[model samples]
Target: MDEQQCWEIIEAARDDAGQAWDHLDERLEHTLTRHLVKLSPPEVARFAEFFRALQHRVNREDLFMAAFLIHHGCDDDGFGDFRAGLVGLGRDWYTRALQDPDVLAEHPAVRARADISALMLAGFRYAPERALEELTGEEYDGYYDSGEPVRLDDPPPQAAPVPRRLEKLAALFPRQQAYLRELYPQLTE
Candidate 1:
């Protein structure tokens, strides 16, 4: 019914208590909580309808985002990394995310996805392992590896490399132009 009540269901679901299952407001928080705890097939089915109703025109996304920040703000490491990221999300993140085709492919909730991802990245930058408060010149050597699943303050990807000269070279043409890509199974789409 309310945020507090919804939160209880979330925490209960996270722990798999199954006691507060009824309290969850058709919101799928309970289902998501279950998914986070242990993803099951049936729960996955429920998420379709749930998220459809749950994430619409940024309103629900904002609510869900706020709740997530409240519930999981502290990422066990006792750092406010996530909080800082969410609050500090800027235009650059939004702009970069817009350029990503896969990001644009996420229809209906495109804006929400962009917002969430930007926040997540910025927050990860503040994480305990290697916070990129201010990157050094050496650290900015075309690559800023935070050494984690998330990138810290690395700038967005540059223009894809153009194989001009390599493509023109008859000898190197076959070897350079999409050669390794075709050769390696993983490299090919």
Candidate 2:
């Protein structure tokens, strides 16, 4: 998809918020996947590199807040956190952020807004599978398109504790709990 088309889809999804998947008639997922497939190898590599770097910066506190915000569908504030945390972090900081996200958390505002939990959740949701598909030039057999019973591999153990805040939110919102379980099955265990 062209930049304009991409932005249009993104805007539409943002407008729909948590229900973007259903509101966009499911075209959003396919469009995104198609766009990913269109990217060159180097571009895809860079994308994967960025996620790995960002993942490295995330701390336990950040993860807790992220999961809380995402489970509650707090997109506006979440977007703010992402922009403020990453916008000015140059290429070098990207490398450093992976080692010590503390630098990104230096500004209290940035720390307050950047939801590393949500970022981590999103990364787990899409990045790895996309990267694998992009690099291998083969589609995963998982039913991403059909929304059927997609096969899931065993999830890695979670090192961090599931915060009480997130536990309460999950209890209140079963859908979010289900979503979280889909991404991090260990949460259920």
On TM-score, the candidate that comes out on top is: 2
The residue ranges of model 2 lying beyond 4 angstroms of the native Cα positions read 1-29, 65-124, 131-189
Write candidate 2's Cα lDDT for 58-168 as tens digits. Answer: 434434343333434435445344422331232344334433333444433333443333232232224335645866768764313322222212222243454323443
**Candidate 1, residues 59-156: lDDT per residue as tens digits?**
22222223233233223222233323222222332333323322322322222332333333232222211111121212322223323232123343
**TM-score of every model versus the real structure:** 0.18, 0.32
Separate clash counts for every candidate:
0, 0
lDDT of 1 at 49: 24
Clashing pairs in 1: none
The regions of model 1 sitting more than 4 angstroms off are 1-74, 77-79, 90-110, 122-189
